[model samples]
Target chain A: MNSSANSTMPIANRTVFFVSDGTGITAETFGHSVLTQFDMKFKQVRLPFIDTLDKAHEAVRKINEAFEKEGARPIVFSTLVKTDLAKVIFASKGMHMDLIQTFVSPLEQELGVKSTHTIGRSHNVADTEEYKNRIEAINFSLAHDDGQSDKNLSTADVILVGVSRSGKTPTSLYLAMQYGIKAANYPLIPEDFERGKLPSCLPAYKHKLFGLSILPERLSEIRNERRPGSKYASLENCRYEVNEAEALMRKEGIRWLSSTAKSIEEISTTILQEIKADVRIY
Target chain B: MNSSANSTMPIANRTVFFVSDGTGITAETFGHSVLTQFDMKFKQVRLPFIDTLDKAHEAVRKINEAFEKEGARPIVFSTLVKTDLAKVIFASKGMHMDLIQTFVSPLEQELGVKSTHTIGRSHNVADTEEYKNRIEAINFSLAHDDGQSDKNLSTADVILVGVSRSGKTPTSLYLAMQYGIKAANYPLIPEDFERGKLPSCLPAYKHKLFGLSILPERLSEIRNERRPGSKYASLENCRYEVNEAEALMRKEGIRWLSSTAKSIEEISTTILQEIKADVRIY
Candidate 1:
């Protein structure tokens, strides 16, 4: 599947280019946000590692070809840092949106310092210490995932508690991957519901607990795919599990949210915002 | 750990805010890209879900407070869509960068259509079919991870083959989560090396195979942490395994890259680029 094109959606009517000097992931993210405001289908293309002048000319030719074939100017979103490369691409047949230079020049004026204007530094891949720590965080999240190990539970920055398929696993992984957060998760199982108590391992980590609940209908639909016609997939069972989970979280005074219609990014960002200390909520 | 601050880095002398009426992910991505060009430190903060005028006022207050405390204008990167909220935030003490409206208005003019300007549409969570497909891809990646299954080998969009801890699992998962690609990964263990051929199941899907190799030194370091003093962690074993795996991949005529120092994001992006069809290379 193309990253920007949905399979079930209509065929793309236009071409969009994410041109960057390095990985181009940041360019893609910026383009997606602005392009999402319009209700048009896009066939996205990425031109990465376009650092040299030769690569820049090649990129322009590609853009022109896309424009000529589509019978419309391809919309180009570029994060090219070098002045020469940007100069070449800006004059292509495509409509250019300079995502970097527009903001960077103004900020340079504000800070009274020139930007380095170097390529491949967008996310700082050269900082080995920071890189090592990021990998460590990912390893930690994997180790503590799905309540697999409680050995280092005390060191977790956050603990996610919820019923199965309530978005705990994916959310935990995203937290670690995107933000370098150390997250652990535990499922609220049938035994815990029957006992009407939190899991045994969670009492000592009450302050780190965050809960995720889901609508019973959505939970049932998700379970049905995994277990088919089993009792675990029944609506009644889903309702009981969701209600018990919510009640347990409430009794335990854990902060919670419903993940029924939310994206994993949404859930992770909200968790970070709510847990954000030092910022006063007016 | 804070999302933007490394643990051992210096104290932040600047305040940075990522504010959006919906999730602030787009704002954060854009901010990080631009801020990375400078030599400075930032105390990063996020203010999300500022849809209402009341919440907009609260966000402005927080920005102003940060500016006063830091004794400089806090750098605010905002993706708010509402005109009124944008006006309110633009007047705050912080130097605001309107990420949404900067290019959105130009695109609206170019397309000859008014933008929807709706809240919570940045990544399109409302499209439930797309959402379900994304979740399905993630589940598919997890199921096929680490040679865990061969049931759906033919269905994958890409198959990542690498030695253990050569960065296959995380790269596979990132490919799935970030781009909705169905990825399966397999490890090239001693048994496969001794056989002197590709894995039995992979022969049928040769067109879909991509390889990841690593430096023997780094591989040894990673394994030592997992099993201290074991033969598996010895430098000689790592050297032999890496050389044998690379030789096998070369003999099979498969394209491969080193994963020794590359980030998971970099590896996934390169995979997509190499696999991308229809775009001309000039």
Candidate 2:
């Protein structure tokens, strides 16, 4: 009665690294970055809390058994080695297992920091009220905002207006998730330009506004890729659009950030700081 | 009566950069990375696909006008300077503007790679069908997957089961987003252990089933943080759950991953790869 007998079991051959105090997001983020560097197969699991000391011992025992049964050393990534938990895992340290601990001992020595408490790095970011708010805001915005055309969004916590592909989606997502703010974004479409004005939905929340603009040449090149041989993808149209967009942004008095040379994280975080909004989640 | 009228133009106090050959994501990525290094205020815009000559001219004209209106030297991040657009922007280059072009002249000089034809970096990644499919799959999964608890998921493309807080939500989201798969996850509740059995719902999709295990000590410590002084968060209970869960995973032949040290990205990608599912978007 193998649990994987009926399902696709596509994850059978891959190794996964899951590190968490209990909630797995923090460890997962770091794990993902490391995983991206490799072209190998793997999977992830984040077990946030075991709920007991005996549970720690049980986990160690299972690790040893799984290793013996599989006949291969699975890669184990772990963090938050509390003394009681560490003792259990230490017993199974080298019995047919390859372990990669992300809360590296080397990192501790390099950073000149040590904690008597071993609650893993995942808990570090969560310990901040400010950080919590921002992440929550980011989630909130994602949940609340709709990326639909013709949706009325007059009541947004922050309204991001930018030309197409100006890092609005990620920025807004980040804001909503990190800050728990209800963020909405509107692309200043070509139609808006033809009419010589900002989209009507924008002015209703004009005061809580920001813009993202990129260099026109950059815009033209991006559009060219999508519609290779059309006037819409023409450099002239790009220039016209960029120019008009800037003029409109200025005319509408919407302050903007140039996506030209900024990362989504930076753009989102900076806007959050400037607006001085309440960014703490819980 | 412009909406921005009440606000002091933040443009003067901020720097803005725009980089493109068109469809601005690539330039924007680099732009974001570089700008992240600086502690400054900036805005962004992205215009993609600027192949025609006239558009380039107009972009520069508008940029020049923006400089005057803002009364500041704008920092322009750009790429693919066709002669016509270059001429227009060049007017602002020395006086009221500073431009950083991503399509480096030095790159051509150093690598001996010359292109009369304009191109972008994103095109390289987008050109491959496999890569495109993967991206598409990931996008599709993201749209469809909501990362909620599923009660009737016996027909899941994949099912992740683990103790509470075992990197389930993010991993599920990653699978859905990156592979366009319908993944569902169910928690191993305490009641299952009290009865010494796997959840009833799991056996049906047993083939596609998976387990996520973590060091019990890590798990215990994690749980302790949330509910201190309870036996549920005690070492003994943790040991019981760990041992029982492992036995359950082993007895049922549900492959389990130790999410002790890995990031979520690593875990998810690894799982995806192990399952031999290509990344895709719907």
Candidate 3:
């Protein structure tokens, strides 16, 4: 199930640690993907903000403890930047996966220069102009969420249209949070469907429109969780809304996909491809 | 500038590509982290959703084009699961950095099992219970946002309190999106200061409370951008709000941090550490 630390298992097949000078999010994210390849669950621990020599040594202690308890070398995925910190962690009693250091030497040789080896450089905040732009994008997306404002519709990178609970809000927030793209979402409610047209305000920004449709069964389950035993959560009404929404999207020539089975990442990536949104790599 | 593809560089010192059979986000994220170790900025391109042979070959062609144009071997970071597709891309005229495959074999040896090697297994979406929990957490955070409701206040994993523009909203959203933490945020306005205490509703949830403070100068600048020339945007008002908010937090023994110089990731990670939120590894 990929649930964290199954207690009943007592001893996990392997122990894993995501160590980083910053948040262990990146280390855990990539390491989790690598581990997903193997159909085995790891007893995972996240040791973040290990920016100091003492903290690095402390991390080594934790890693060694896990290795001894598990009776095998733990898997350590680290993004620690300081060479001294890296050396300390690499010497731990675990199969250390240094995400950053492995490539730094090769990259240094290729670029003919010394590596910065700067910890926490990857997530510098609003101090950088680019980071500030990301903040603005988040604000824009929030202000314009749920068709809240049309004054700045012209500025949006992509405007998502979908039936209620058809996975619009989370997707829009992800675009803003993850990619710094201004995303505004609108729910294709019964009113829009009865009009036999796309939302009147959306026509002017037709090219930027992306639609997310969902299977009736999944839509019903998701909605029923929010408002149970209501007509809005009924399969019949969900079917109607989905059909009409798809019809409107098809007629209006807006690119669309059924998001019933897609993750937010997959949906966002597809939208970026279709809208040709400028990829802003942080 | 870290901007993509500086044309004025004529031929960039190096060209880099993040190629993946999925969104390429994972590839780009780690690749970017590794690249940040070097001081030089390279021309960058992302080739995502390269699942088919045609798309895989297309990626190779693009990588070759960048190599030819840059007059240097490009660096390719890939997470493609299919061996045939990876073979095609790796054989291109660039230095290949397969993020997934590099560690896959080692992980296999450690786990003593053959990898499923499933493409897109990392983000299986709402089909999985964990992913559904993420969606529920996002919806929960959105509903409980800005202290909108106290009905579910006890259910919240963390309740963030701060003055306006202290970055509570985006931080909450990031926690929900990235880590599935049920975060609720509240803004400590002049009214709360006038009352000379924490919000009445927050006392019971003191154990779950986290506060964010900001530099008055930065707060004033951020608020001014939203509400130009208003008293709320004035530095004096911002100073009063921040001082009062921090005082309230200190009096309540609520753990807090200044968000003025932190990214949303940094802020969220700090909150997680303080709140002891159960780590959900997806």
Candidate 4:
């Protein structure tokens, strides 16, 4: 039955290009994400660092080649900052979706000013202090990962407490990298459950703490992959840990959420929103 | 001088909305990145989880309100999958940039097939193995950070070596998070400089190694922020460490790049391109 169903499905045979004046990361990210909404698959080509007029012309030629070979107008998603360069690509046979120009003019008129019209300044290292803060946040998170250090608990903006395999590490790193937040995560262990309280180091910083709980089945599956056929991977153990952790969080009046159904982006965004952190820098 | 210059600069007064049926992270990221190319700022609003027609109408109402108040057509970047929902926003006074529809039609014609027209599948947790791989990569990178663990030396896809504060940790973490590459970073300390060779554990995995170097002045500045008025933070010391680290990398025939001026994204992209890693999953 599965083979028959698969045979009836149509195959994808289109080409797509992400053209940019800089790293092309933004074009590719936005383009791929939008493409995923459709069932069609694409052969994606990235043309990065197209800063010069000559490079832009070369990109147009390549795009035209794809158009001719495929007998279809290939799609082009571009973030080109220069108007002249964007015009060159816009003239190509492909259908152009200019990300920057489509919005920049309206923004300029609304602000009653002109744009900088610069290339590669969006994610560049133009500001030193922002870069320093990102690095410092990364370092702080690393030092305090898995309850490794106790020196700077007071300095942390948010201390994530959760059971093992409950996804505290990735969420912490994402918070730091994306929003420059100083986040530290500590794993709640069986000892903490026996003690019937939070960790000793967390009492002074209870207001800054956030909790993550996972479904018992999902937690058991994740733990089983790490250490197979162990008591730590047992379903009964996972259920007990999750229950105790939730109870402790509710007793402490701390905010908590389930990591079982959410992605890292969702988890981090929810934490930032719940904690009322300033997320404008992102 | 700074206060006088700041007073002359105009503040931005435009409102921008990122409307989507999912997390809206892609719309926000692409919109904000493109907006940064211009000098004008915006009051940004994100309306996510808009999966129904009623919710879509609410978004259109909100967008039109912004337009009426500002007396300008606000910019709307949307990734809504449903045509009816997207059309509702398109009819608003705001300038609507339908990210998915702008390209999906060309792609459909090119492929001679119809799209699945699914919602919320781009970054969803529909597949278990992909999530497991991401978590495993994060765990591996964390365990091997700063040469802390030698147990998984053979399992790493890339090992980053550099002097302290050359951005090995953040780059490693970014690679793991974005591309699911198993990355480990080792700090090249003074003891390694005294011996004048690569670390003992790195000799067997020479082909899998990448090096990060930074400007001496920048390195000194970064170190000084951590430990002020120490020999380790001296410019002369920083120069010695960076020079020796570069020499060691060259002698070992390893690829290296300076992280002084590049963003973490740029550095990671360069390494991925040079190493020929399969980064298409991103």
Largest DockQ belongs to which candidate? 3
Which residue pairs collide in model 3, if any?
A: none
Estimate every model's Cα lDDT from 0 to 1: 0.81, 0.52, 0.80, 0.78
Q: Where does model 3 exceed 4 Å of error?
A: A1-11, A278-282, B1-13, B278-282
Q: What is the Cα-based TM-score of model 2?
A: 0.42
**What tens-digit string does per-residue lDDT give for candidate 4 at A177-252?**
7667899998888898899888899989999999999999999998998899899999999999999999888989
What is model 3's native contact fraction?
A: 0.44
lDDT of 3 by residue, A177-239 (tens): 777788999878889888988778999999888899999999999889889999999999999
* Docking model 3 quality class: acceptable
Error of 2 at B230 (Å): 41
| Residue-by-residue lDDT tens digits, candidate 1, B1-282 | 212234454444568888898878788788878876766667777888888999999989998998888788888998988899999998899988887779999988777778778876765473455566667888898889888898888889899998898989888878877777889999999999999988798989988999999999999999999999888989999999999999999999888999877878778878987777324211
- DockQ comparisons of all candidates to the true complex: 0.39, 0.03, 0.48, 0.32
lDDT over C-alpha atoms for residue A66 of model 2? 51
Q: Please count the clashing residue pairs in each candidate, in the order shown.
A: 0, 128, 0, 0
Model 4: which residue pairs collide? none
Worst 10 residues of 3 chain B by lDDT: B1-10
**Interface RMSD, one decimal, each candidate:** 5.4, 15.1, 4.1, 7.4
Q: What ranges in model 2 sit over 4 Å off?
A: A1-18, A28-78, A90-154, A216-235, A260-263, A278-282, B1-138, B141-282
Instruction: Please provide, for model 4 over B76-140, each residue's C-alpha lDDT reduced to its tens digit, 9 standing for 90 to 100.
Output: 88887888888887898887776687767776665566766777555565243555566678789
- After superposition of all CA atoms, the RMSD between model 4 and the true structure is 4.5
Residues A1-282 of candidate 1 have per-residue lDDT tens digits of 212234454544568898999888888788878877776668778888898899999999999998889888888998978888999999999888977888999888877778778776655362355556566777887788788898889988899999998989888877877776789999999999999998899999999999999999999998999999989999999999999999989988999999988888889888987777324211
Q: What proportion of true contacts does candidate 4 retain?
A: 0.27
